[model samples]
Target: MCELLGMSANVPTDICFSFTGLIQRGGNTGPHKDGWGITFYEGKGFRTFKDPQPSCDSKIAELVQNYPIKSRAVVSHIRQANRGQVNLENTHPFTRELWGRYWTFAHNGQLTDYQKLNTGHFRPVGETDSELSFCWLLQKLEQRFPEPPQDMEAMFAYVAECCDELRELGVYNMLLSDGEYVMTYCTNHLYWITRKAPFGKATLLDEDVTINFQEETTPNDVVSVVATQPLTGNETWHRMKPGEYNLFHFGERVGGNVDELADVAFAEAKPKSQAPTEPL
Candidate 1:
C-alpha cells in the first residue's frame, strides 16, 4: 500500500508543512520507501514532480521542502510497491487532461483484477494498478460526459458511484482533483483537517517541527488537508468512515456521503497546546 496526501485552499497556499511530515514516511519514519510523486495545481494548469527514489533521500524532495510553491490544490503520494516496479514510470500522482482541464490522481491500496477494466482513450503509461485505475476512471467520465457538465453536484455523485464500484474490487482510498475541486474516497484509512479563522499552531507527528498558522495566515484564509494518516499530532483530524466520499472546494466540504453530526463533533473538539514555531 501507498500513502496519500492532499490539500485544497481558498487562497494559494504552500504545503511545505504537511509535505515535510509525509516525506519522512517515504523512508525515514515509515516503510513506504518505493517511490514518491507530487502534483500542484495552479489555475487550470498543473505541474508534477516524481522520483523513483525514496522521498527521504531524493534531492528533488528536499528542494520542494524548501521552496514554497503556493497553489489552490495539491496531491502527493509515497509508494510501497504492491503491484508495480519501483520506477519513475510507476510513480503515483498521475495526471491527464480532461475537458480542457488537467486532472490529477493519487491512490493507496491494491486491487485484484484491475486489468480487466477497459480504458477507452486514456491509457496508462505504467504498469501500476494505481495508474490503470486512474485511466479507467477518466475514460468512464468522458464516456458519461463528452463535455464538462454544468451540474457539478450530479457529476460528483457519478464520481462517487464510480468509486464505489472500484472499492468493491479492493481498498480504494484516493485523492482526485481537476484544479478546482478535490474529491476523496476512503475504503480504509483516511483523515482530514480544515483550518479557518482563529487559526492555531500545529505540530508534525513525524518530525520535530511546529508552525503557528495564525502568524502565517490571514483570518479569512481557509485551508484543508487530507492524508492516509494524521500528519499533525495535536490537531484533530476527521477520520472518514469506510465507503465515505467527500468533495472539497476552497477548503470547505461541499458534498459527499458524510455524517453531519460527526462533522459537528469534530468542529467542537478543542485543539491541543501550541508548540514553538519554526520558519518553513
Candidate 2:
C-alpha cells in the first residue's frame, strides 16, 4: 500500500519536519519506495514536486527537505506499486479541476472491483485504482450538484455516503482538498496531530532530528497534520477508526462522519473531542 501525508493550518506553514520523517518511509524506514509526490496550496496557486524514484534517495526529496514553501493546505504521497507501474504518470496526489477550484487527492489503499465505477467528465491519466476512484468521486459530485453545493453539511454527508459505497470494494483511506478545506476518510489506519500556541519540541520516529515547534510558530498559529501513521514518536496523535471521516479547514476539524451513527451505543465508540470549525 502507499502512504499519505496532509496538512491544514490557520496560517501559512511548511511541512519540512513531518515530511522528513515520511520520506524515510519511502525506502529507509519502510517499504513504500516506488515514487513520491507532494502538493502545496497557497491561495489560488499551488506547487507540486514529484519523482518516480525512492524518495529517501531522490534529489527532489532532498530539495523538498531544504526548501520551505509555506502553504495552508498540503497533500503528499509515497507509493509502493500495486496496480500502477512505477512511472511519473502513475504517481499519487492526482489533481483535477472541479467547481473552478483545483482539487487534489491521494489514496493509501487498494480497491478491488473498481473497474465497474464510471466517470463522465473526470478521467484518469494513469492505470491506478486510486486515480480511478478519485475521478469517479469528482464525477459523481458534479452529477449531484452540477456546481458546488450551497449546503455544505449536506454536500459532505453525500461525500461520506460515496465513501461508504467505495468501502464495499476494499480499503479506501484517502485525503482530498479543494484549496479551502481538506476531507479525510479512513478505512484502516490514519492518525492526526494538531500543534498550537503551546507547542513543544518533538523528535521524528524515523530520523534522529529534533525540533522545537514553539520557536517557529506564533501564538495564534494552529497547524494540523494527518498521516497514514504517526510521524513523531513523542507526539500524541489521534487515530481515526475504520468507517470514519473528518473534514478540516484552517487547521481545525469542522466535520465528522460515522456511517452507522444511528445506534446510540456505537455513537460513543470513538473519540468525541474536536468540534466542527466552520459551515464548510
Candidate 3:
C-alpha cells in the first residue's frame, strides 16, 4: 500500500512541515518507501517533483523541504510497492491533460480485477493500477461532459459516482484535483484538517519539529490539509466514512451536511490519506 497527502486552501500556503513529516514515513517511520512525489498548483499549471527513492533520503525530497513552493492546492504521495516495480515511471501523483487542463491524481489502495476499465483519451505512462485508474477516470469525464460544468455540485456527484465504480474493483482511496478544487474519496482510511484565524502550534508524529501556525499565517488564512492519517497530535482529524467522498474549495468543505460537518471537525484525528511519478 501507499500513503496520500493533499491540500486545498483559500490562499497560497506552504506544505513544508507536513511534507517533511510525510517524507519520513516514506522510509523511516513507515513502510511506504518505494517512491515519493509532490505537486503544487500555480493557477492552471503545477510544479511537480518525483523520485524512485524513499522520501526521507531522496535529494528531491530534501529540495522540497527546503523550497517554499506555496499553492492554493497540493497533493503528495509516498509508495510501498505492490503492483508496480520500483522505477521512475511507476511513481505517482499521476497527471494527464483533460478538458484542456492538467488533471492530477494519486491513490493508496489496491484494485483487484481492475484491468477491464477503458482509458480512451487518457493514457498511462506508468505501469500501475493507480495510473490506469486516473486515465480511466479522465476518459469517463470527457465522455460525460465535453466541457467543465458550471454546476459544480453536479460535477462533484458525477465524480463521486465514477470513483464508486472504481471501488467495485478494490480499495480506491484517492485524491484528485484539476487546479481549481480537490475531490477526495475513501476506500479505507483518510483524514483532513483546516487552519483558520485561531491557528495554533502543532507537532508532527514522525518528526520532533513543531510549527506555531499562528505566527506564520494571516488572520484571513484558511488552509486545509488532508492525509492518510493524523500528522499532529492535537487537532481532531475527521475520518471520511466508507463509500463517502468530499469536495474542498477555498480551504473548506463545500455542500456540508450536519454529519459531514461533524466529520470535518473530527478529520484530523482519523485514519489516514499522492500526486505523480514524473519529475518536474
In terms of lDDT, the best-performing candidate is: 1
RMSD of each: 3.2, 6.6, 6.2
- By TM-score, rank the candidates, best first: 1, 3, 2
Off by more than 4 A, model 2: 258-280
lDDT for each residue of candidate 1 in 159-220, tens digit (9 for 90 to 100): 88998999989999999999889989999988888888778778787887878898899989
List the candidate 1 regions with Cα displacement exceeding 4 Å: 260-280
Tell me the spans in candidate 3 whose CA falls farther than 4 Å from its real position. Answer: 256-258, 264-280
Model 3 per-residue lDDT at 92: 90
* Per-residue lDDT of candidate 3, residues 1-280 (tens digit): 8889999988899899999889989889899889999989999999889999999889989989998898999989999998879999899998778767888899989998778889886677868999999888888888888887678767777888888898899999999988778878888888877778777777677777767787799989998888888777666677777778888886987842226665554422321211111111
Per-residue error (Å), model 2, residue 254: 0.8
Better model by lDDT, 1 or 3? 1
lDDT value, candidate 2, whole model: 0.85
Tens digits of lDDT, candidate 2, 18-49: 99989999999889999999999999778889
